[model samples]
Target: MATASTIFSDCSSSTTARLVPLSRIRNGILQFRQSVSVGWKPKNPSLNFISTHGRSSSSIVTVAMATEPSATVIDGKSVAKKIRDEIRSEISRMKDATGIVPGLAVILVGDRKDSATYVRNKKRACEAVGITSYEVHLPENSTEEEVLNSISGFNDDPSVHGILVQLPLPPHMNEETILNEVSIKKDVDGFHPLNIGRLAMRGREPLFVPCTPKGCIELLHRYGIEIKGKRAVVIGRSNIVGMPAALLLQREDATITIVHSRTKHPEEITSQADIIISAVGQPNMVRGSWIKPGAVIIDVGINPIEDAQSPRGYRLVGDVCYEEACKVASAITPVPGGVGPMTIAMLLSNTLVSAKRAHNFE
Candidate 1:
């Protein structure tokens, strides 16, 4: 019978450390509980994941030891604040110089709580940056033609420089048709087929990039992460975040591979990536073992899971397991505070850009 140390020695050596499931070492031998202090900053010189278990339920127990986690936390919330300030300053200067202020129009249908909250937030963000926001809220039973009419109205309004159609529209509505109605120049959400097509081309540029994916790349750039010549993996293929993220990464000259539900041996593929952007809406799907040591991780998923301890009966989590990835990756983004804020900030950015182009403002 091999000891737990002997069994896992082959998995990692004394010089190298890797996280493994404690239950896998010996089926009936050990039971351990791991806990880390909430809001514990990772600036300490040592990798710290505290274990507090008085008694072992199994015959033998082994702990996963690791060196100091040096991963830089990609602070999206702070970066977003900086971006908003910059946008605010630019808007003031533009307004002063040309007496022109950027304006964003949003057409929202249905009454989904999440969608309503998102629309409200966008309106608030627009107001914060001195951008005028116009909204049309329709009942859930509204027809596609009605939504299209609103978009058409915005398209012709010179005062409205950016147009966004809140997503997850009623199932009966034709998303493609509705998205296409917004003039390409004012399509700030960047979901139009023409915008996506332009983004995919080498020599062409879309008037606006999707907010969430654009924010992911922006976070990387602000952090001084080099994307050129890197091996990148996008862990989803949805048109919104994953696909656009891959295209954006490609535009930055990084070699790209997409892993979807059908991909075999995801861990093996992910381990080789220098940069990984996960947008698969699965809670804690990517573990420590799936990460490459020193790789940069941009987690775009915001999945809610039931949590009895919470007042809301649920809590938000990202696709990448934050605790596990923090130990292995060189840098990572936290959910809620990570890609979430950036999305709205980028939306504001797109609106400002559209306003600048529309007014021929420098």
Candidate 2:
């Protein structure tokens, strides 16, 4: 059996060795309480990645690159707000000159409360950006043909420029069939096989990128994080976020590695990355130890877990333990305020772009 020591053998020594605590190496997350400041700071030339300073001879712990709390909190909510304002500005300009307003259509199947909430949020986002929103909420018992008909209707509508089918359709429905029914140009959610295929090709660009993945990359760009030549690791291989995210990173010239469920020594692989996008939906699955100091983290997982202290009896958290990660990562996104808001922002952005292309507004 590989102990924490053996598992972390590759991360031995130096100013830039990967930080891995023995407790995390043994299990998933260590049950400990600590706090660190989460904000950006200017880099000091004198400060550098140094050796472990306060560890006992027998203690199994690694040191972060910097002594000071250097990690910057990636403010996704503020960034999302900025993007929405920008979209709103562009939308106003297009409508004023060309009398053309972007429109987004959503086809939501089933009655999952969470799914309904997401659809509502998307509508609100569209309206805020001056885009019209069209929606169809089909009952759980609706036939696949009925859903396809809705998609076809929206596809031909001149006013509707973007279409999204809310995911996790009823167990009886064929998700793939329904998703492919959407027109390639109107696939704003970017779940169609063709969009993903285009995203994978070097010379090709996706007509619309998956919202969450696009937002993650946008956060990086908004913060001026360099992607070219940086090594990135994406945990999870789901089509929605992880796979597309890795593809986008690769397109930007970042060397990419994907960590899935069967990956061995996941921490070891994650630590090698200059950027980590964790979308496994496992709360706090990534601990501080798995990160490379100075690595930028964009957490996509929004998991709800029981919390006795909360009034709702539960709270949301991301895959990376924020408190721990803040200590090591040069920048990171918070859970509810991070990827969540950005997803809607990207959806609006895509809708605006689709309308612009359809009408050639610009």
Among these predictions, the greatest lDDT belongs to 1
Worst 10 residues of 2 by lDDT: 1-10
lDDT of 1 at 245: 93
For model 1 the local lDDT of residue 134 reads 99
Candidate 2 residue lDDT tens string, 2-73 = 111111112112122223221121011112122111122213322322222222232322433233464677
For candidate 1, lDDT tens digit of each residue in 1-362? 11111111111111122222221211001111222111212332233232211222223223333334546778889999999999999999999999999999989999977678888998999999999999999999999999999999999999999998887788999988999899999999888888899999999999999988999999999999999999999987777888899999999999999987667667778878999998876556666667778999998876655555569765666767675577678898877678888998999999999999999999
Model 2 scores a C-alpha lDDT of 0.76
lDDT of 2 at 85: 98
